[model samples]
Target: MPLRVLSTLDAAKTQYYHFKAIIVAGMGIFTDAYDLFCIPPITRMLGHIYYKSNNSRIQPAAEAAMLVVALLGTVIGQLVFGWLGDHVGRRRVYGFSLMLMIAGSIGCGFSMGTTQARVLASLGFFRFLLGLGIGGDYPLSATIMSEFANKKKRGAFIAAVFSMQGIGILASSIVTMVVCRIFGRKDHSTNDADIAWRLILMLGVVPTALTYYWRMMMPETARYTALVELNVLQAARDMGRVLDVPLSQIAEVDLVPPSPPSYPLFSRKFFFLHGRDLLACSALWFLIDIVFYSSNLCQSHIFDIKDDGSAFDAAFKVAQFQAKVACYFTIPGYFAAVFLIDRVGRLRIQVVGFVLMAGLYFFCTYLYIKDSRGVPFVMYGMAFFFANCGPNTTTFIVPAELFPARFRSTCHGIAGAAGKLGAMIGAAGFFLISKGGDDPNRDEKKTGIEVILITLGGICVAGTAVTMLLTRETMGISLEDNEKEYEGESVQGKCFP
Candidate 1:
């Protein structure tokens, strides 16, 4: 028997609760982006504070540890919390992730040691904890928003939540600008820079902690309640209040046991039915993040801030340049995806993003080889724009929608982990390659940053093929109907559990 509450939730018109859920859910993502992106500039400031007396930048190994440890934490968090969300309940596990984030942020801000190595080690450990929290937010927020939204506007709603990431990135730049301006001084000194980085890192908790109570207060998603928990009556009542529907409209007699059992996550039956979808989602996410995270390092190269001034001036300049990119390109790209995702369809947008990014990367390599100045910056900026407007947003949204609710969180978490894996590769690989290319004594073609960009371009081309082959169009379809369609396909192909 079909659960009427699940159907009502899928068909309900957009309402105030929808926007409220977006803000509540989106704030977690906003904090995620800020906490992740804010570190790069802060790391630069850290080098000035702790390593300046040595007459060198932060050691490459230490810097890489600082940059990548959070991504590692995110991967673990996505898998652990994602499984927990399914077994215990989404609402129950949600608060734990947020709490971890708060603790980690505070810990990083206060990270201390007598020696520079000890301090870096302490910071890395706390950031790993922070990453765990950020990772948990990924599947929980995306799946929650997806399950709660109406099918008609579901893509847009989820995209809107993901778009908060743009604001978070912007906020990172703004916060850096404000902090650097406050600490700006005429002479070279580590004291002010040390205070500024700690304050900046600690401030990430403000918006995140503010949303904690509201996140805890949200009702369990009706889809999860009825379809997963088998609590039809409670689902009906909760959604009734949220959607402003009269309880009488959903007949009490219609409350019944969920029928047509779906295959469990990772089972043989699920493999036959959803293996392709799962593979596509994971691969696309992985491929896109390779380019996306790699591009993040391009800011320093693209903007090319001269190191002639005080470290404070350089931090301020980096923040200003990043802010300009966020304002002009990155943030706009996110909202553009939000506005058009429901209309243009997820698969199409992703293919477009990959194709455009591949072309842009190739163009960037060409520009770099030509020794061109003043133009590669725009090329790199456009690459960022399309990544957000296309694959980055769509990859997050697709996994949440394409899987059955039983396996939704798990599958989304897996795909998200794959993306972060790609991010780790991108961050580490780009760093190594860029380091080699910048060596005054090295001239190998293989070690050049241009080669890395071209390799990324090639990866994007492969992503386009993989996306088209693996993923199905999910636009404008209810979650239940999507589940049913998969079952029908499996049956017609004579696949059985």
Candidate 2:
């Protein structure tokens, strides 16, 4: 019928605006991708200068520190930025996080002697700052994008944005290979060491500024306007414009029920509604971070097939460094999501991903137990597949859809901080296990590498279990209801607490 045709047309046009808004919000996710992925190369560069030996505890510390510090910084960033975003506006916090990323990146590049206490202190401060920015991106981008996207498509859109972390991390690897080639690993002096890191740090500014550029070109979300600006008529007008609906369909009345402009994150009312959801979501994130960081932070180790003393030497050397950089997949993953996301649902993809990842981790665990390289590589490859499919990509998408605008960022921040705490646990977990068991170094009751992989495998399995029990299917639904469910109350329909 003509009516059906018209309805379809209207839906398509509305989607165009949703697409644009999702694109804008997803840019911040791109930064997260870069931060996680890029740090590896910088750490590798540190190996060339400071650690000089890839196997040194210092190298592991630097790599783990890269994630741990960033994770720690994110804890602060999430709490600070999330509160500000909800209080001020997502756009404002988005910009604020970008600035911090730029400053942190540049500061990291300028790090002084790891030998010097002052330099180490400086490194910690700025790396933490960068983490803060990276951390801030999750809630801001996910919430803003989810609000703008159609409910049917929100999960996919959120998944797409979060998937950018893989892309950003991958791109860092690419850049590392190129940059290291240009500035080979061995000038040997502290000055030379600092130079490469500085260059990498400076590059962080480019994305930081570029995010703002795109935001300025876009308008604040109609949803944000509806909720925060208290203008239903204007919100409707904006919505109508984006959806291409007749002005009449978007009546002059406010769409969201009227309520107080401000609310606290921890108010009893909010907690009762959202507490369980937050706990489950946060725990899930913690599990993901444990495996995600443990694997990615030790990317170089994944390629090692032999325990032969000479093989590790070959890998640890500057020559094989290119291979290490190749491990980054965040960049390519992010770009690919730009296309695949609009077409798929987040939960579906995530479930698929986790299933595949469970298999891969299990395989990796087996190989470690068997003392064979084949299964490790196989699992590594499978993880690459899973990165595209689910856990790595889709977990980040959930909070964006489930939380109401009022608590969206807050819930996201809490989840993210929890994940960062997981990252800290993961980062430390690897080094601790890698420490020679029984014998402080060299001799071991078990291979440190196997211990780490098995642990990650166990974590991945735990995620699979929790996700099945705690994860709700978020396929097609009215996005407006997500906000309405809370209808000015935190728990009205939330999965929290």
Q: Which ten residues in a row have the lowest lDDT in candidate 1?
A: 488-497
lDDT of 2 by residue, 92-183 (tens): 66877877777777777777663744665678778888888877877888777776665445556676666655545555555555555555
CA lDDT scores, all candidates in order? 0.81, 0.61
> Candidate 2 — worst ten consecutive residues by lDDT sum?
1-10
Off by over 4 Å in 2: 1-19, 51-59, 113-116, 185-193, 237-269, 302-348, 372-375, 436-446, 484-497
- In the predicted model 1, the residue pairs found to clash are none
- Backbone clashes (count) for model 1: 0
Score every model by TM-score.
Answer: 0.94, 0.82
Question: What's the lDDT of the predicted structure labeled candidate 2?
Answer: 0.61
lDDT of 1 at 295: 68
- Per-residue lDDT over 232-326 for candidate 1, one digit per residue giving the tens place of the 0 to 100 score: 78887887777778887654574457664656667888887788888988998999888887668445643445544555776677677778888
